[model samples]
Target: MMSINFEQLKERSLVIRKRYHELERIHHESEWTVEEDALAFLTDAGLVGRHVMSQQGRWPKENTEEELKHKIGESIWWLTILAERMDINIGEATESFLTKTEKLFEK
Candidate 1:
């Protein structure tokens, strides 16, 4: 895989999302609503939590490390899509969050 910066990743994600939307329209005669996208994100986020529980031996079924890793990445992809749909800049939001959290822990 090629190395990509955040901007490039966001662009690629948008392209992929557009293609998915097109496919959805062709198959179902409508693309997913923003609320549907958000629900999808939530579903994936829940899977991430389940994987973490598996890692900690708290889940009934064991999950592989690779499964957990991929789920985490997928959750991030969902977040980027959600931010784009909501007209938010995910990069800026993440930066602001990190900066604010760091300031709170400063000596």
Candidate 2:
């Protein structure tokens, strides 16, 4: 069985958040509102990123680094919210994931 490090998971999450902040620094003009804004933001990012992927062209819309950073942080926010909503901890989630993965590996 492979070992999962809880600290490493948290660190990766923080790294992603840090990158998001870096992006925000580069794209600071953007003003964002949350929740309803998340869907629109993802749609725009996906669309632009997809266009860039498909046609090798730039997106017409401008998304700031801060907005990008917020998106990444938002994921962590959602995850934390889920943990709180379900009354679970990061450790519990880690254990559950480990158990499920191990069960699959045993098959």
Candidate 3:
């Protein structure tokens, strides 16, 4: 198992984003729009849900567990990319959400 902090993940996401842009330039002559990126994220997120359903036996499929794991990771990658594209600091944002939610649940 490998351990990576959010900063490392962000750096890797940026590297992948650059490669994706290169491919887009080669094939489409332009980078994808933010909306397009969001749509792609949504597509992966939907797959995560479908895989979960399959895992629960609501939808029948072989290898649901592996596919679910992949989709979950892909969704997180897309979210990190989206946050970067929108100029949001994902780590800070995640911390803020966690802190706020935890406070709300405090006894």
Candidate 4:
């Protein structure tokens, strides 16, 4: 399988988010508030997390690794949308987070 670089993901995320915003602008009567966008992001993230837990047999619902992977991808897309709205750089944020985690845990 091929791997994608950070720049590629960032560009693709921007494109996808632009398309989403365009659709929202055309379909919705008004813009969503930052809090509402945040809530949507949190909801999607929770779904992915719960799906993973279920796959681990921690819940009653049926979930597979492939399904969990798909949800994770979707969650990241949502995260990108949220990050853009908040003026956060997703690639840089991810790098900084991993750097901090490694320092904290000596990984």
Give the candidate number with the greatest lDDT: 3
**Candidate rank order under TM-score:** 3, 1, 4, 2
Evaluated against the true structure, the overall lDDT of model 3 is: 0.93
Clashes of 3: 0
Give a tens-digit lDDT track for model 2, residues 10-62: 55655664566577667884433344335554565564444444343344444
What is each predicted model's overall lDDT from 0 to 1? 0.89, 0.55, 0.93, 0.80
Say what the RMSD of model 2 is: 9.6
TM-score for each candidate, following the candidate numbering: 0.89, 0.35, 0.96, 0.78
Output the lDDT of residue 92, model 3.
100
Checking candidate 2 for backbone clashes, the offending pairs are: 20-69, 23-65, 24-65, 24-66, 27-65
Worst 10 residues of 1 by lDDT: 1-10
Candidate 3 residue-wise lDDT, 1-107, digit = tens: 89788899899989999999999999999999999999999999999999999999899787789889999998999999999999999999999999999999996
Q: In angstroms, give how far residue 46 of model 3 lies from its true place.
A: 0.2
User: Model 4: clashing residue pairs?
Assistant: none
**lDDT of candidate 4?**
0.80
The 10-residue segment with the lowest total lDDT in model 4: 29-38
After superposing all C-alphas onto the true structure, candidate 4 shows an RMSD in angstroms of: 2.4
Best TM-score among the predictions, by candidate number: 3
Worst 10 residues of 2 by lDDT: 29-38
Clashes of each: 0, 5, 0, 0
lDDT of 1 by residue, 1-43 (tens): 6766668768988999999999999999999999999899899
